[model samples]
Target: MKKENVVIITPCFNENTTVIAFLKQIEEVAGKLPFLFEVIVVDDCSSDQTLSMLQKFSFVSENITLTILPLRFNVGHQSAIYQGLLYAQHLDADKFIIMDSDGEDDPEAIAELVKFNDYDIVNVARGRRKESISFQISYYVYRFIFKIITGKILNFGNFCMIKKKVLETSCHTSFIHFAAHLSKQKVKSTSITFNRLKRIDGKSKMNLTSLVHHAFKSFVEYAEELLMVFLRIFILVILLFFGIIGVVLYKKLFTDEAILGWASTMTVNLFTAALVCVGFFVMGILLLNMISRRNQNKTEIFVKLAEKSELLNQN
Candidate 1:
């Protein structure tokens, strides 16, 4: 039998209703595609019947391989996809696709992505985002911060495809944001335009605090660069702190009408002291990131096998 390799990985969390809708669209898309398609669905220990429902969903087609990897516990969205990517590395796939099970990423676009085997990776950039005004604003701010720290403008999410060459290393990254790790791969990245779709089921698992945390994780990956940015800013602030002090001293020394009193001295002292405190705080954060990078275990991120080919037969 002639088989061409392509795999899709999706991280599922309480997506009981949405996964079924997602797979049905995949089935429709798979029928028209020209290669063998295998799907790796990582269940991040959903507290609902998402896993069980997926077990039932495994019987879409006998030809298509449906593997459900249920983690030992919930480890968040990116971790689930990371586990799936680690598993996909062993599949000897020609192409690997990452998308969401909440139906925000269109399954119909899979063929469009998988067609590009020229580059190591092809990311789908959203031409139209189906997000709220608040979310859009937050995402823009997040991207702006990302640009400052990493010197890269990342406009895509996990809706992308990578060849096997990129998968071997991209899967095992310590960075929580998989896209950030992929961005650092230095391989040629191709992009296509796609419109984002709304979720089919429950609300997003990420809140504002979670979004901030997610953005922070990316910065954590580029800790050295972030430390440099901090240092540069620190230098400017210190210079400004002393510049104000110099101005105060110049007025006290060189001017006749200068208000020379204890109030002025206390104010200058207060500003310099506040700057020092802020410097220590920023230094502490960078130090923590350095320590975290040193302690991160790339290979130890756990992935427990739930069911592989059994999903097809059991359903």
Candidate 2:
């Protein structure tokens, strides 16, 4: 039996404080796994000694490779990971594993991920979150909202293993695309519980603002999948508007003091106006989706730029 070609791709930005230790753990974990493995570290325009440190390691090790791309500006976390995954796909690896360099995701879990060979994408779900209780609660709540909006619940993050083909296809969609592409492929995907560890060296790259931005972007990016949500809301809006009017008219015709007065008229007008605004908003979103789909369907500009840049680097 041939050993599977496995590639580990990590996105590091200003991770000088933790990159060395992260690499060492990768080496240790690969030694225990029963496959031919390679490591690709993408330095996302780090201003610190992160790239320097990676270069120093790359020269000494044949199995380890490094590519540092100096972005015109910071492209955010998901785009950085997409770049690395594309690199991994170009190498023709059988499987691609993505992880963060902050040591929060345990490198040892690679063995367990590889064991789930049946799954085209294997995710390490955090069985135990190491953050504050409030943060954890908020995180799950966000996940629920995300599921409600996108029709897919993402319980994992960059710490997941995916098939090479899925990685290639998904990376082409958006600079900041999520792993939903695999799910859309109906690829065999599964999750395993893992206890998230605390960061040892540096602060988390994700701040509160960045996290919120990520959530909003995903909602917008996958809006097409949530059309049913808008449809349902639209129906409810129309029904509620008419229902209120019906109630007002019923009261005016039936009993007691005549209710068809200025207050009732104003209430009905306000409700009708609210429904009109919502209807316009939903229609606008649908129009944008139609435009976006017509534009490229799946291709993203940054991914193409990255591919071109990688080609130049090879030359």
Candidate 3:
């Protein structure tokens, strides 16, 4: 059998204090696995000592094949991950794995991820959360709202593996939201149970406000679907508005009884107003999507944030 080139991609910002230990754990775990593997770390331009530290670690590490990719500027976590995937594509990697640099995703889980060769994507489901009760509550609230709005439950995070073909298709999406993108594929991927580990170093970069922003950000990936839902609603309301108007007209023109009360009159007016309002909002959203797509040439945006490999450890 051929030895497939497996890759692990991580996006880091100010993780210098903890990334070495994280990489060490990955090295130890990877040594026990049989396939050819490489660790790809994308450093989202950080203010701390993380860049230098990764350089130093790369200089000394001999057990693992590591590549330190530093971005030209900070593009946030999702973009960083996307750039890493693009580089993996350049390297012709067979299996691409993505995880958080904060060490919340256990390195040991990599073994379980690759075992299922049949899956195009392997998503990790959080079996136990290590966050505080408040955080958990907030997460549940976000998940509940996500399901209510998009009809898809948000359970997984960045901890997942994608085959090269899946990765190619996924990069075309607006954002690298693993759960939402994989859900869009509807490919029947497999998932494994894993606990969310507490951060090994600094506090989480995302606060409640950022978390809310993150939750809503998934919509960018589902723009078409969201537009369809809104269009359906708008159409339904317009149809109902006409139906009610027809009913009211029938009562006034075709009925033999006396004119009806104000209830039917008010319903027609309110529904007409609602239909117009919905039409305006839906058109605005579609216009926004068009402008967004024009502004967002993902390949161009990510390419501008180019990566340079520092030879600080692997072969």
lDDT of 2 by residue, 1-120 (tens): 867778887777778859878888777777766677777666676677765566556434444444444433455677677667655566757788888888999988998887766678
- Model 1 residue 65 distance off true place after TM-score fit, in angstroms: 0.5
lDDT for 253 in candidate 2 is: 80
Q: What is the lDDT of candidate 1?
A: 0.77
Clashing pairs in 2: none
Q: Rank the candidates by TM-score, best first.
A: 3, 1, 2
For model 2, state the Cα shift of residue 129 in Å.
Answer: 1.9
User: Which candidate leads in lDDT?
Assistant: 1
Q: 1-315 in candidate 3: lDDT tens per residue?
A: 766778899989888778888888887777777777889888887778887787777523343488777776788888798888777777757688899978889888998997878888888888897777887889899888777667886789889998888887766654545567677786758788899887877466667787777876676556666666766767777777777677778877989765558647767676876777687567758766784784366663332322343322221
Q: Enumerate residue pairs that collide in model 1.
A: none
Model 2: ten consecutive residues of lowest lDDT: 297-306
For candidate 3, the lDDT comes to 0.75
